[model samples]
Target chain A: MVRLNNLQKEYKGFKLNVSLEIPEGCVTGLIGRNGAGKTTTIKSILGLVKPTAGEIEVFGKAPVELTAKEKQQIGVALSESGFCMIFTIEDVIKVLKASYEDFNEDEFRNKCTAQSLPFDKQIKDFSSGMKAKLRVLTAMSHKAKLLILDEPTAGLDVIARNDILALIRKYLEEDPTRSIIISSHISSDLEGLCDDIYMINDGKIILHEDTDRLLGNYGLIKVSSEEFETLDKKYIVASQKDRFSVTCLTSEKQFYIDNYPKTVIENAHIDDIIVLMLDTSKEG
Target chain B: MKIIINNTSMVPVYEQLMDQIKQEIIGGGLKEGDALPSVRNLAGELKISALTVKKAYDKLEEDGFTVTVHGKGSYVAATDIPLALEARRKAVEEEFSEAVSKARSAGLEDDEIREILEILLEDS
Candidate 1:
């Protein structure tokens, strides 16, 4: 259970402010484009960066005040620069065993071997997929109650992503109270993994929706200027326009489909929604 | 026991799963009292969100197609034969109407469409 109430952070020109909650027993996806403050938000949650304003609470306490025992209950796998590259797998294992109270060395090594990662080899020599797996393995092997995955499948092929996803599902099955906050540029990954999704852009929270409702109800409508003028404006959440036509994103696709039967309604995917929410040229 | 889905199609994945499961139950492919896979198992097998699988399962339970015990998994429910038959008939009628409309839109005459159906029925 993670909660952010009016969380705000300032970085010169960019201001990150989002109010969201990751409920227990669900995967919450934080989705955004590059430089959209997804990493900043994750960092705030991890206590890696201090917020300029507002507040953040993880596991019912400030992230900074999270005790070592409490920290053992959380598993974090950041995308950029995981553990020291110079350390060999065995050395990293030893360090983790010393670091966390609940660290299971045998489980760690077995998972490493299961993923075909060589224990004798240094992390610097490992491939991107291997490194990704190692980071996830490191985070997951210890039975953490909350898993914070920052692009856990980034830069990996389809096979590796699925393998990691399957492992994540198994992890959830192992406990009923566990939760995850996964941020990704890959919409399909979030599409199949998340119970809820929060879209961020320009350091602002644009959309917070249940995955099923978002996918099922939201859609895109491309209509001429005349049609746009006559159409109801209540359903348009975001919009883009050109001289010939206007493409508006609507969360009430069924209403438009039934009432404006002549209009063409297209299903709005996570990717399309992100694009339209983040990119604003001509607002309808 | 198995459901295939087209992600690019208009139908939502959960709805697709619900429809396929209902059809399977009605067709007797999945018999009454048969156990459905656990939510986690199905999610892993389909490579979809557990929440999506949960949604489908919840809809099935709500519609009386399945019953789920809290700790245990879900099972196909014994159907009310009359209601099940009505549902099947409605589904068939909807499909037939769609096909007839498609044929009509393609410029086929009513007699031609009727003849095609009669020939298919006879051949079967």
Candidate 2:
């Protein structure tokens, strides 16, 4: 549904050069720490920021070149922006109805009521969770075929985060062909939702893997310096040394499980990958 | 069939899913010709990617545990009962062998390990 070919964007110091493909009916996750160029990549896809070089295609056309109908097919809920805070829920609904031809006003209103968002109060008066829900509800109300959600669950409590994630799941379940690109620092959010994951760091695509393969194959092995010295480094992708032990990241987890019976091996979670894969040190 | 995923398990989600479905079929919870839930439905219910569910279903079909008819979803395969039972017995025997080896490593004599197994069998 979306494709980026060597998409590059440059600021004063940081440069983002990423190649990503979001196939139809797949939910792809973009994960990284703050200032890791996640937002830059998202902005480039939305055509909110002009790329310094390379190409981005949303629905087979440049995002900026998309027709009005094509634009309506893409739902966007940016992290730091939404409707005017002064507008009440009713006002926002009116704006949505005016903006999109397919917007379902009654369904949107019912969802807002179900979420316990008061219609009379301005959006600025709503809690963070309430505002977040409104943004997602608005995005889904138009029956968009693709959703570009940036931190939809950011800053929310666990319950709130689960609720938002459930909403996204419901949206996908409604249409099996729909696709989404969700960007978040929250690994758990992406872990359950995305089919594939892209790890970005220092304005570059560091790793891309299918979520299933990642959970199945990636592992972290902790070994003392002596054991580390004897350990085969063929499967080790990245490693770091602490004062007492060396932590190694390996993609061939089953190799170590079969050969190194005495070594401590743990499955690598997304958070572990973020830390270990993003580490600048090379495997020794 | 109820499918519970252990998020913290070292096993992959698709493998865990395949195991649960296999157990259901073997234990008679899922009988031959029973239609499995659609991949999208299971994925939504489990809050996992549909691709993962599809992978498990594909693997089950490949293993002759299930059969897929295009657009009709998956169904428990009409497996050979005696062969299935024999496979399960072999799996149990392997488990016992592993347990006995561990017991021997811990310095337990053959008689002690046999006694423990008898006692566990009586309780079961």
Candidate 3:
């Protein structure tokens, strides 16, 4: 549903060059730490930021070139941007109703009530969780085929995060063909929701792997320096040495499980992947 | 069928899913010709990617535990009872061997491990 080919955005010292593909019926995650160019990539895809080089195609056309009707096919909820703070939920609903032909006012209203968001209160008075819910509800209300959610669950408590994730899941269930690109620093959110993940660092796409393969194949092998010295290093992707032991990241987890039965092998989570991948230590 | 996913498991979610479904089928909780939930429905219910559920369903079909009819969803396949039983036994044997290995690594005697197994079997 969306494709980026060497999409580059330059800003002073920070440069983002990423190539990603979000196929129809897939939920792709863009994951990285703060200042890792995730928002830049999302903005580039949404055509909010003009790319310094390369191309982005959304639904077979450039995001900037999308017609009004074509633009309606994509729903967006940006973290730092939303409706005017002075506007109430009721007013926001009215504005959305006028803006999108596919907007379902009843669904929007019911969701707001269900979420316990006061329709008469200004958005400025809403809690962070309430505002987050409103943003997601607004995005999903228009029946868009694709959702570009940038940190939809950011800064929310556990319950609030789960609620937002559930809303996204329900939106996908309503239409099996719908696709989503959810960018978040919260690894657990993407771990459960995304089919595949793209790990962005600094300004480059560091790693891209299917969630299944990542969970199944990636592992962290912990061993003392002596054990590490004797260990077969073929599968090791990255390793870091501490005072007494070493932690090695390996993509071929099964190989180690089969061969190094005594070695302490832990499952590599998204957080581990980010940390170890970003670690500057080399595999010897 | 109730499916529980352990997010922290070393086993992949899809594999965990497949294992659960296989167990349900073998234990008669899920019978032949029973229609499995649609990919989207199960994914939503599990709060997992539809692609993961689809992968499990595809693997189950490839292993002859389920059959997929386009637009009709997936259904439990008629089982070869002996073959299914053999597969279950093999899996249990592997688990037992791993348990024995772990017990040995923990410095348990062979007799102690066997006694523990027998006691567990009697309780079961």
Compared with the true structure, all predictions reach lDDT values of: 0.87, 0.90, 0.90
User: Model 1 over residues A12-53: C-alpha lDDT tens digits?
Assistant: 889989999988888889998888889999999999999988
Residues B4-114 of candidate 1 have per-residue lDDT tens digits of 977766677799999999888888888989999888677667767778889999999999999998888899998785697897789999999999999999999999999
Candidate 3 stretches with Cα past 4 Å from truth are A281-284, B86-117, B122-124
lDDT of 1 at B94: 100
Q: If both were scored by TM-score, which would come out higher, candidate 1 or candidate 3?
A: 3
Segments in model 2 whose C-alpha atoms lie over 4 Å from true places: A281-284, B90-113, B119-124
lDDT of 2 at A178: 89
What TM-score would you give candidate 3 relative to the actual structure?
Answer: 0.91
Ranking by DockQ: 2, 3, 1
Q: Write the per-residue lDDT of candidate 3 for residues B1-116, one digit (tens) a residue.
A: 77899977777789999999998898888999999998988988887767789999999999999999997899999978569889779999999899989999999999999899
**How good is the docking of model 2, by CAPRI class?**
medium
Residue pairs that clash (backbone atoms under 3 angstroms), model 3: none
Clashes of each: 0, 0, 0
| Ten residues in sequence with the least summed lDDT for candidate 3 chain A | A275-284
* Per-residue C-alpha lDDT of model 2 across residues A236-261, encoded as one tens digit per residue: 98888899999999998989989997
Deviation of model 2 at A63, angstroms: 1.2
What lDDT tens digits, residue by residue, belong to model 3 across residues A199-248?
98888988999987777789999999999988999988888889978999
TM-score, predicted candidate 2 vs. hidden true structure? 0.92
Candidate 3 CAPRI level: medium
